[model samples]
Target: MGTWDIGPFDNDTAADFSYRVDEAPDGERADVLLAAFREVTGTGDEYLDADLAMEAIASAALLAAQCPGGEPVTTSYGPKKPLGVLPGELRPPAVAALDRILAADSELLELWEESGADEWKAGVLRLREVLTGA
Candidate 1:
């Protein structure tokens, strides 16, 4: 929950997630990203934890980096090694996770709303647009 900026990898949970991605076997990094996305998307009607949301955001950022017009993840806190070409299949779930995070029950959204960080929300929206090529 130690968020220092609006970027996906700026928070402690997401920074830790980047390490998980870096440490995962090359073929398993996408699994790590999928798990993060599913954790948020599968939350259903339950309150979505901010940490989970952060990890999902980080996951989406990594995937989005490979898309056309997507910015490369340059944060030092992001994965150090290249993630290889991620599956295009991940985009749908990444967008779903983002939608869930922006939903009313998301703790991350609540926190950002309280903090008046419209840019954070906007960043998440931009990620969605990138994933959907909208």
Candidate 2:
């Protein structure tokens, strides 16, 4: 996927958060970025539109980078809300696109060293757990 500019969504706050996430390195910085995205996007609610879905998927891909093999993290709890409700046929390709984005970005994983953002990191990890199925 090409670089996404923040369009008119939630008074442009979504764009700001997305940009931050895009710029963040791995570890705590990335975790904070993801948390900010979730907070600004209000992703916890149901009925995610396409733009929000893409944002959530991108965040998920970033979180997946921290996990080994980039596979979904298995967890004991289920997802609270649908991350992005894509059509059945489109879901696979969308996920593939996000994975490609993650793969192409080397700096994301390279900066995964500890940064003392434990709370934010745990928040992103919890979202990952929900996304992947715990």
Candidate 3:
């Protein structure tokens, strides 16, 4: 997985995803994020792979950063280009994608559990809380 930490952009896949987002045109940046989230939420109960989960988590972090209480994504691995304010509509799908990533069949979830990553799990939950504004 090439993961070094629990942050959304801490891994190679997510770092690559950040570049992808940066390369996207300003008007289409939100679409890029939406696509990542949908890749997980649209998979239903299928086993979610780590890379997909990573991208979705990155996307959610970007969206959440725009919320009132949400923290900004200041990591170097996060997108270099500013995404501007994403639409409020993205929140629901971002939450759904997070749910899917934490679900039983998700490879990312299993990997974290096997590694006894309580902090990682908590970070994901924090992302969810930011997304839902709870």
Mind giving the per-residue lDDT tens digits that candidate 3 earns over 33-61? 99999999888878889999999999998
RMSD vs true structure, all candidates: 0.9, 15.2, 0.9
- Supply the global lDDT for candidate 1: 0.93
Best by lDDT: 1
The Cα RMSD in angstroms, rounded to one decimal, for candidate 3 relative to the true structure is 0.9
Worst 10 residues of 3 by lDDT: 125-134
TM-scores for all predictions: 0.97, 0.30, 0.97
Candidate 1: stretches off by over 4 Å: none
Error of 3 at 129 (Å): 0.7
Clashes of each: 0, 4, 0
Candidates 2 and 3 compared: the better one by lDDT is: 3
Q: What TM-score does candidate 3 get on C-alpha atoms?
A: 0.97
CA lDDT, every model vs. true structure:
0.93, 0.37, 0.92
Ranked by TM-score from best down, the candidates are: 1, 3, 2
Candidate numbers, best lDDT first, in rank order: 1, 3, 2
- Residue 122 C-alpha lDDT in model 1: 89
